[model samples]
Target: MTTAATSTTAAAAVPFRFFDVHVVRTRLLGRSMVRITFGGAGLTDFASGGRDQRFKLFLPHPGQDAPVVPTEAGEDWFPQWRALDPATRGIMRSYTVRAQRRTDGGAEVDVDFALHGADATGHTSSGPAARWAARAGAGDRAVLLGPVEPDNAGVDFRPPAGTDWVLLTGDETALPAVAGILEALPDGTDARVWIEVPHPEDIQQLDTGAQAEITWLVRDGADGPRTGLIPDAVRAARLPDGTGYAWIAGEAGTVRALRRHLVGDRGFDRKAITFTGYWRKGATEEQLVEEALSGTGPADD
Candidate 1:
């Protein structure tokens, strides 16, 4: 009964539909990240809203060739999927769209996965999605709850009109979205970016027309404790003058602190900042899903 109510609420969300996709290829970005490309006839209608576009991805369990999603429920698929036995049901996760391109065969979408835990091989400490991403290959099947229209609600990196500058910060888990946002910034847009990664190799070359200065914070080579590096860096920097919009994501606690710092200490209006907690430290995605179900809630974008 509770699941039915939850599903009804979630199902009413607009402009998203399920599409079946299969992996076309994979690339190792670094020791801690991998990029997977998915394509099929179904992706012909997959329209990405670009910058920070997010979607739900479902993967199969061990020994299963395809994810066991109850798409037959149609628009109310969420409830049916929720009722499946955990061990037999599909593994659902959220991800950001890095890019969408056309090839001779069809349209393909690129998604970058941050490999956490022991190392980039993604063999240790990774949940289902990371492990699947690390080992995924051409022909691997999955399902995506993606947008059909270019202008959809799945994207969240909106800087309101007349913003003079922008500040963006995140850890590796939020890097893909940050890259997309930077790529979409207008020419000469003053932008400041901060990114934290476990290793230096995880740093990416971001190309953007915006007048962007990006600072990469590497945990492995830091002088002091790896903790609070981003907050410390932001505190010591001189921000550009004028109206600024901020987007901060990653560990929930850090995100809250940064948001508080921006609003309380930096004197920025709360309305000028967009904050999302991609993940909470020490909490599994499953736990997060449960929280959402129970209305404790954070449905990250």
Candidate 2:
């Protein structure tokens, strides 16, 4: 591993590529959230654009010790990785760059995982990514496909210029990105945020300099079904006036409902609201990707 601190200057102008990284540490941020920090020699070239920055993490499959580092570069990497035998391919998942920092040891990136709930039998069952996070330890390796340039234009958080206020809404899966966006907002900027989580203990203390009004909604024990909680909360909240941008992400159905409420009921411009479905109720990420390839999945944006 590299012991030098990451450079603060601009990153080299390079295309996005795969970086082999190892777990530096893991910690519990909340009842259902585990933060895993990754660092390695390849992180020296890792550049983060902050707000809602996303990357593909290739995690080791069951019984495997580490992810197979793909040899192809740029656009060829995905095709090569896809062509591998299913039994040998690593589990690929999308995640947000919660934050990145330069430490005395090297550059480190944080990715937070939301632990899934248990079945009716009361036994805990999590997805592959969450299970990996739960058991991951120092020195465990994975592969990250992300931007090598600091200001990579692929980042999704593009609030229009002259935005007087901001509205942010999402579920547990989007917490990291929402937190990163809040922290990156200009100090004293007006913002409203609503985050829904599985448990009340999942509410975390977000460090943001923005003038943010935050509301946390607990869903696991809420009255009625959990499906409509997010949209209900959004429907009841008072929106701010003036030209503003709204960033909404969560389950596909809920995200669509919120977007419709903003555009149809609230009279906000469709172009001004940015929405994404982080996941669906029963659909896995792989399934969603397959559906997207076939033009059957929910709109990514």
Model 2: pairs clashing at backbone N, Cα or C within 3 Å: none
Candidate topping TM-score: 1
Clashing pairs in 1: none
* Model 1 TM-score on a 0 to 1 scale: 0.91
In order, the Cα lDDT scores of the candidates are 0.81, 0.76
Which digits, one per residue and each the tens of the lDDT, describe model 2 over residues 1-301?
0000110123344577788889999888767788899997668778888888777788998789887656564567767777777568887777889888887767899999876652223334556676777777899999988887767744667777778899999888889989989999999999999999888788999999999999998887765223687788879888788987888887777788888898888887777787777777666656765565455764432
Candidate with the greatest lDDT versus the true structure: 1
- Cα RMSDs, all models: 4.6, 6.2
Alpha-carbon shift of residue 35 in model 2 (angstroms): 0.3
**Residue-by-residue lDDT tens digits, candidate 1, 37-70:** 9998878788888988888899998799999998
Model 1 weakest 10-residue run by lDDT: 1-10
Stretches of model 2 off by over 4 angstroms after superposition: 1-14, 118-124, 222-226, 299-301
